[model samples]
Every structure is written in structure tokens, then in C-alpha cells.
Target chain A: MDFATLIQILDSTVRLATPLLFACLAGLFSERAGVFDIGLEGKMLAAAFLSGAVAAVTGNVWLGMFAGIGASLLMAAIHGLASITFRGNQLISGVAINFLAAGLTVLLGQNWFGLGGRTPALTSGGRFEPIILPFAEAMAPVPVLGPIYSELISGHSFPVYLAWAMVPATAWLLYRTRFGLRLRAVGENPAAVDTAGVSVTAIRYAAVAICGVLCGLAGAYLATGLAAGFGKDMTAGRGFIALAALIFAKWRPWYALGACLLFGFLEAVGNRFPNIDLGLIVLPAQFMQALPYILTVVILAGFVGKAIPPRAGGEPYVKER
Target chain B: MTAMPKWADAVLVPLISLLIAFVISGLVILAIGENPMEAMRIMVSGALGSTYGWGYTLYYATNFIFTGLAVSVAFHAGLFNIGGEGQAGVGGLGVALACLYIPWPHWSLALAAALVASAVFGAAWAAIPAWLQAKRGSHIVITTIMFNFIASALLVYVLVNILRPTGSMDASSARFAEHLRLPRLNEILALVGIPFNNRNPANISFLLGLVACVAVWVLMWRTRLGYELRAFGKSEKAAVYAGISPVKITMAAMLISGALAGMMAVNTVMGEAQRLILNSVEGAGFIGIAVALMGRSHPFGVLLAALLFGFLYQGGAELALWTKIPRELIVVIQALVILFTGALDNMVRRPVETLFLMARKGR
Candidate 1:
């Protein structure tokens, strides 16, 4: 409740929100291109496991991150092949991808590590080290802005800053670029885009691939930046939470940052205060954990506001038909 | 006219998909430096070789049967109800409350009351999402996913704060009274002079599951409502023009799905544990999706798919216990099965249909 505690909570918020930010942006890209991706969680989980394992084995976080991305991309390719190429049920494909990553990660982890589906603990070089901003020490002497700068924004690992930076970059890419215009058009009405000579399939595949890369970053952050290594099901429904954040943000980039940060703040508050007794009704931490999902459902039911999806979303484009 | 025989559509397509899934699963095993053939042998023997194995398999199958049927009923109504896990969890809570609070004089009366309680609770959990989907245009898939998390949170709160016995470390309800516990399957078998495994968790709920499958078949195929539901599913605009209320069909189908999902709790919570515990549903709800997909949304198909999964589950446990292969291998197989049968059906179907066409033309 105090300033220092508030700063501390915000610090953890930045850390926790980093993964959600990456994932929300990922979903935004895919859903905006007419491909509904519920497999974000699975991709993140696979990436987390692969990154953690590779980091532990090779003692290189960058290699770990790439390995994670590769794993996610492989799954994304499978999703694209099924839902895009074969015109399969997108939701079912997502569900299968989730199950596939979940099973394969633990099975491979147990077989390789022999430690009950967990990678080896990440060493110093295997993990992302917190980088101190140049003026953090100097800023610590100032009154109001000091702790906010030094504690809240200056000491997070690289991904936290990168995740924040991606918000604007994604906004620019989505709203100001020609590719983005075509992508939005494809999602809204693929037939028009196809008639205009833009390949809907190509645009969708690109979006899904972008989705895979962002999910990879999210997973890598969880493994090497947030925690020291991967644990089984370590993403732990964060992908779904990111999906909720996407809806809460109305599939926009800047709003996605706000949504992820808000959800992250709730998690931080929950962690800090496990149980809160208000003299009458006590609130459990589970409420905080479930808040994002509950709020999204409310938004979805149009209680707060309507959150409409892209018109052509979840439908495969069949040119001849 | 259909391009292929009805039997091929029903049987051949799924079989081919299953074969491809198994082959891919075998390759995965091989990649891990394990012999897929040996693993298959172990699974087959471990799950089907002994009475004990069959007991566990049947018990797990009972849970699947209920959840699978739940998914199938919804599929027929053109609704994808993936909230089976949450519904089943709430149903377990209902079962626990019914057993703990109700002072039933006999077990039969207790079972009946518990069944109704669970179905009601499960359906109630599903009702909000169904209503939103029906009236507000909310996607059922997303809403149900959110509800699953809400149900989990609710279960944790109830178990930890309300149901847990004082001074207990675990978050679970107190055990039900001894006489209230359902009879084990072996106990019933012994009454008829048939021998079976006595120590396994298999119980009378398995029989109830079989009965429910038959009931579902009757409800889905032999009833007027089923026709309306199927008609609505096939083409909503057409059904509307033909005088079917979309709202009514949506609510009815989801409610039936929810109730069927809820009944899975009878097998897990009442028959096996005799106490409600956190995570009692334990992914069986999701497994129902795979079962329904593989079974093509038919009750009899659901039964077979459920049994196959039950075998995988029991066999995977044995594999994990004995070999280097983990139990999650079964989940991988399940994913592959879903991918092939549900998502990538056209990958196999197209080639098969073409083959049939070519053969007919040649003839």
C-alpha cells in the first residue's frame, strides 16, 4: 500500500506482464489475419521447455531462445497445415496442438533429463540477467521519480523492456503498414482480398508464423527471464490469460499492453497478499488469479461492452468455393 | 448419392486416421530411443491381460463415457461444449454435498439423489455460458474456456476454505459414511456368482455409464427433439424456416451436454474417492473432446472411443511405471488422434474418396 511496496508490486508487474504482452500481440496478429489461435498456450509451453532445456545444456540463453522459437514454429506450421491448408476445424487443431505440446514437452523432458519432466536448473549465463539502466543509481537520489525509475523500470531483464517496446512497434505495424492493411482486409473479408490478388493463405500463414515467434519470446521469457528454468506446464494457462487480455484489449496493440499490465498487477497483488480480510468478507488469492478470465467473460457477454471479432475469423478461405 | 459406402464413411476413414496417428506416435517413440513395438506390447498386455487391468481400464472408461457422451450430444446440436471439465468439477461438488449432508437410509436412494444433484449443478455451471452464446452472440468456445478456469477457482476456494476438515493439510471433503459408498463392481459381480478383481476402484457406476449410453442413443436418434436438434445443427437458417427455435435447441443441447458431463463425477468422486477433492475431474473433461471426435459424435462410437482411451490411460500408467517412457505418451497419442480424426480429417478423407470414385468408375 505504501510507495515502496507499490513500486515493488509494479516491478513484479512488469516481470509478470512481459510474457502476457508478447502472447497478446501474437494473438492480435493471428486473429487479425483471420486465423484463430487457441494454441498459444501450447506453443508457449513448448518454447518454455525447449528454451529451458537448451539453456541448461548449452549454457547459452540466446541459443535457448532460438530453440524455443523453433519448437513453437514447428507447432505453428502444423496448425497452419491443418487449419489453413486442409481447411480443418481451427478450434480442434488448436486443442490438438495444446495437447501435443503438453505431452511431448513432458515426455521428452523426462526422457532427456530424467528428472521427472523438469530441465536442469538454469545457471547464471543460462538465465537472462537483470540489466541496470545507466542512470538508475543517479536517479535513486531523487525524491518522487527516483524509486519509480530505479526500482520499477530500471532493473527488469531484457524481455520486459522488449515486451513494452513491442506495443508501439506492433501498433505501427498494424495501423500504418501496407501489409497490415491487407492483413486486416483478409481477416475482415478474405474474398475481397483474394479478388484484389492478395493471397489470403499467404497472409494467414505469415500472421500465424508471427504469432509463433511472439509466443516463442513469451515462453523463453518464462523459462530464462522470469523463472530460472522450465517446469512442467510452466506456462500454466498464461496463454489463455493472454487470449483473455486480447479480447479485453479489443485486439489492439496499445490496449493489449494495458490489459496485460493490469492482469499482471492483479497477479502481483495476489502474490504479495495471499489472503485479505476486510473485517467481513475475506478474498482468496484464487479470485485474483481468476479475475482476468471472469472479466473477459463479462466483456464477452456484452455486459461491459461488445468485443466483436474479425468477420472472416475462424473460417478457411476457399477460393473456388 | 454418396461417393463411398456408408460403412466406409463410418468406419474406414477413422481407421485410416487412427493408423496414421499410431504410426506417428511410433516414430515419436523411436525418436526417444525406445522401441515402439515393445511399448505397444506392454500397453496391450498391461491394459487387457489381467482382470485387475480391466478393472482400472473399465473404471477410467466410465468417466470417459459420461464426458464423451456429453460432447457428442452438444456436437449433434451444433454446439461445441468444451466446459466439460468445469461442469464435471461442479458436479463432483454436488455429489460431495449430497453424500455428506443428506441422511439417506439406503445407498440406492443416495445414488439417485446424488445423480440428480450432480446433473443439476453441472447444468447450472454451463447455463450461463450457453445463455450468453444463445442470446448475446458470445462464442461458446471462448466463454466455456473462461468458465473452466472460473470453476477451478471456485473448487479451490470451496475445498480449501469450506470443505477441508480442520487441521487437514489436503484440500478435500471429509469422507462419506461407509454404508453410503456405492458398491464395488466386484461386489455386484460376486452377488451373481461371477468372479472379478476385488481390490480395484471399479464400481457400479460403470454399469450406470453403460445405461446412460443407451439412454443417450434413444434420446438422440429415436426422439422428436433429437430430430429437431440435428436439423438445427445441420442448417440453422433452414431449421429456423422450418419452425425450430434456435434458442430452445441451443439451451436444450447444452443442458444435456452439461448433465452428461456432470454424471462423470459419480464415477470419480462417489465411486472411487468417496470424497470431493480438488482436481477430481483431472483432464477427463478434455479427454471427452478427443473421444467424441474419434467416435464421430455417436453414442456407440463414444463408448468405443472411451474404452480405447481408458486402455491407453491404464497401459500408459504401466508403461511409465516400468519403462523409460512417461505416461504422457498416451496424451501425445491422444493429440495425434484428435489432429487426424477431427482437424485433419480431409487429409485422409480426400484421398480415400478419390480412390473409391476411381474404383467405381473402373467397375
Candidate 2:
């Protein structure tokens, strides 16, 4: 209710929303390219574990991030091989990837670290440090805008800023570029795009690779930026939440930012207040935690509006003779 | 659709896929500095060598049967019902209330009441998503997945506030009344003059699972509703043209699926734990997806797939207990099975089909 609490809540929202933002944007790319990826959670988990393990060993956050991205890209490649190359069921492939990630992460983690599927906590240099923006100290004297700028915007790890910046970058790439036009076309009507001399498979693989890169950043952020180490299933259900946000945002980059922030705000509030007493009725923390999923279901049910997916989504495009 | 014989299509493909998965899993074991052959021996001996092992394996199989059938039913209606985890969790609430509050004179009577209660609760939980998909055009996969989370949270709230015994730190209810406890499999076996592992948790619910499998087979193949459900799943527009209501079929299929998922509570809650606890369903709901897929969504196939998974589960536990193989590797193995049999079926099928076609041509 007070200013400090409000600022704290907003700050937490920024931190929590960063991963969701990266993942939502990732899903946006894949889905917009006609791949229904439910394996985002698995990819993120793999990256999180790899990043944390590599960071613990090398003591370099950048190297850790590279390893994380490499790991995620490998997973994306496997998904591509199964779904795109083999022309298999995309959903089944996604589920397999998820299962593989969940198992392999813990198995390898236990093998290497022996701390029960968890990497050792990274030291300062191994993790992403918060960046204090220029003039933050001097601007502290200013009343309303000062603390907001310094506390809320200034001191986040690099990925937070990268994720925020990616919104526009994604928008530009998705709308302003020729590749974007083809990608959207591939998702909606691949036959038409194929007729135009475009290779649907190449475009789809590119989209999935881009998705892998973003998911790698998101997973790296969770381990190296936010949590310092990776535990088993640390990404939890955030990938699914990101998918929900993708649907909630209607597969748009800008709307994904809003949906991620909203979901993040809900999580922050739930963490801050275990039980909310509003003088009349008390709300349980579990209710708050469950709110996003409940809201997603409501939205998908068309209580809010219709969320129509790409026409060619989920089906492997078959070229006609 | 293939020139291959039905036996080869049904049996040969899955056997080859399973062999491939196990071979890959064996290599993984070797990578972990363990003997692959030794691990296989241990897994088999631990899961089936003793009565104790069989008890646990059957217990796990019982849970899989219920959840697998749930997925198979929904698959028939072309719905991917991934909310089995949540549905089973809510079903536990039904089991808890029935066992704790009702003064059933016998376990049989209590089991009957709990069956209906759990089914109704699970069906109710799945109804919203089914309705949304049927009417509002919402994707059932997304809604059902979201519902799984909601179900977990709801169960937690109920257990923490209402079901937890007073002054107890555990997020579990007090033990159910003695009369409500289902008979363990050992007791039933003893009546037939056979010795069994008395301490093992395998219970009469195993029989219930078998019955459910038969029931599902009859419903899916023998009943008119099953015809309509399958018809709708094959092609919705065609079904509509044939005068079958998509809405009714979707709701019916989902309801039956939820009910089957919910029935898993009977095995975990009344048969084994004898009380409601958080995480009672574990990941059986997700495992059901793989089971259903591997089984080709057929009841008989589901039964075999469930037993295979049950073996892996119980064997994985033993491996963890005695060997260096982490329990999570079993999940990797299961995932590989699913990947080969379900996702990459064409990889093997194509080669085999070609072989079969060549053989026919030679003949």
C-alpha cells in the first residue's frame, strides 16, 4: 500500500517477468512460424542446468550463458529433427523433449556435481551482477521519478534489459523484415509460401533456432541472473506459463510483454503477502499462485476474447505433388 | 493402411521400439560408469524376482491403468486430456471425504461410494475445459494443462486448511477408518491358499484396474456411444454431416476420461496410503500420456504398456536404492520409449513397410 512496498512489488515484478518475457517472445516466434512448441519448459530447464553447472565450473557468467544457449539449441535441433525433418507429430515430439530434459538434467547433474541434481552455488563473478545505470546516485535526490528510475529500472541484471529490448527487436524482425513476412506466411499458408519459391522447412527451422536462443537467455537468467544455481525442475512450469501468455497475447510481441508483466506482478504479490487481509475477506496465497492459470483458462474459453492460432500451426506441412 | 500384417504392426513395431529404447538406456547406464548388463539384470530381478517386487509393480500398474485409460478415452474423442494429474488430485479429495466422514460398515461398501464420488469430482473438474473446447473453441490441451496446476493448488488449500489433522505438521489427513481400508492383494491371495508379500502395498484395486480395462474395451468397441466418439474424432465435419453432435461426444469422452483418471485415487488413497496426502498422484498423470500413446490408445495395449511402465517404476526404485543409477534416468528411458513408439513411429514403420512390400513382391 505504501510507496516502499509498491516499489518493492514493481521491482520484483521486473525480476520475475524477465524469464517469462524471454520465453513468451520465444514461443511467439515458434508459433508464428507454425510450430506448436509445448517443450519450451524442457528447453529452459536444460539451459538452466547447463548454465549453472558451467558457471560453477568456469566461474564466468558469459561462458555459462554460452553453454546454456548451446544446450538449448541442441534441444531445439532435436525437436526440429523429430517434428520438422521426420514430419512427425509436433506435440508428441515436444512432450518427448520435455521428458528428456527433465530426466537428463537431473541425471547429469547428479553425475557431475553429486549434490542431488543441483549445481553448486555460483560465486559473484560466475553470476550476473546487477548493473547500476549512470546518474542513478545523483538522481536519487529527485522525488517521484528518482527512486522509480534507480530502484525499479536501474539495478537489474543484463538479461532483464536484453529481454525488454527484445520486444521491439522482435516486433521489427517480425513485421519490418522480409524474413518476417515469409515466416508469418509460412505459418498461415505454407503452400502459398512454397509456391512463391520459399522453403518452409528452412524458415521453420530458423524460427525454432531463434526460439532456442531466446529460451537459452531466459534459462540462463533464471540460473545465473536470478537464482545463482539450478535445481531440478527449477524452470518449474514457467514454460507452460509462457505458452499461456503467448496465447493470452494473441502471439504478438508487445502484448506478450504486458501478459508476462501481469503474470509476474501476480507472482510477486503472492510472494509478498501470503495471506491478504482486506478488512472484509482474506485471500489465501494459493489462490494468488493459481490465479494466472485460472485466468488463462478463462481467457482461452473466450470469456475475454477469441485466441485464434495460425492456420498451419501443429500440422507438419506436406508438399503436394 | 500398411501392407504389413496386423500382428507385425501391433506387436513387432513396439517390440523393436522398446528394444531400441532399452539399448539406448543401456548405453546411458554405461556412460554413468555402471555395467549395462548388470543394471538390466537388477531391474528385472528387482521388479519380478520376488513376491515383494511383484506387489509394488502391480500397485504401480494399477495407478497407470486408470490414468492410461483416461487418456485413451479422451484420445478417442480427439481430445488431449493432460489434466489427469489434477483430476486425480481432485479425486483424492473425494476419496478423503468419503473415507473420513462416511460410516461405511465394510470396505466394499466404502470402495463403491468412493468410486462414484471420485468419478463425479474428476468429471466436474474436466467439464469446464471440455465445455470450453466444445462451445467456445478454446484449445482443450491448453485449458486442461492450466487446470492441472489449478487442481494442485486447490488440493493444497484443502489439505492445509481442512484435511490436515490438528497440530500435525504434515500436509496430510488422519488415517482413514479401519473399515474403509481396502484389502491388500496378499489378503485376497491368502484366501486362495497362496502365500504373498503381506507388507507390500498392492491391494484389491489391482483387480479394479483390470475390471476398468475390460469395461473400457467394451465401452470403446462394443457401445454405440463409442462409435460416435470415434467417428467424431476421425473427422468432426464428417461426423456432423452424419448427424453426430460434436458437443455431446466431446463432453461424454472427456467425462469418461476424467472419471477414469479419478479412479486412480482408489488405488493410491484407499488401497495404499489409506489417507489423503499432497502429491498423491505424483507424475502418474503425465506418465499416462506416454502409456496411452505407446498402447495406441487401445485398452489391451494400454494394459501391457502400463505393466511395462510399472516394471520400470518399481525397478527404478530398486536401482536407486541399491545402485548408482539415479531414479530420474527411468524417466529418460520412458521418454525414449514414447519418442520411438509415438513420435518417431514412421522411422521404423517406413523401413518395415518397405521390407514387407519387397517380401510380398518376391512371393
Quote model 2's TM-score for chain B.
Answer: 0.98
Model 2 docking tier (incorrect/acceptable/medium/high): medium
- TM-scores for candidates 1 onward, in order: 0.99, 0.99
lDDT for each residue of candidate 1 in B63-142, tens digit (9 for 90 to 100):
99999999999999899998999999999999999999989998899999999999999999889999999999999999
Q: How high is the lDDT of residue A153 in model 2?
A: 86
Off by over 4 Å in 2: none
TM-score of 1: 0.99
Q: Give all candidates' CA lDDT scores.
A: 0.94, 0.92
Give the per-residue lDDT digits (tens) of candidate 1, residues A86-195: 99999999999999999999999998999889999999999999999999999998997999999997988888888999999999998999999999998999999999
Model 2 chain B: weakest 10-residue lDDT segment is B341-350
* Runs off by more than 4 Å, candidate 1: none
lDDT of each residue in B264-283, candidate 2, tens digit only: 99999999899999999989
Q: Pick the candidate with the highest lDDT.
A: 1
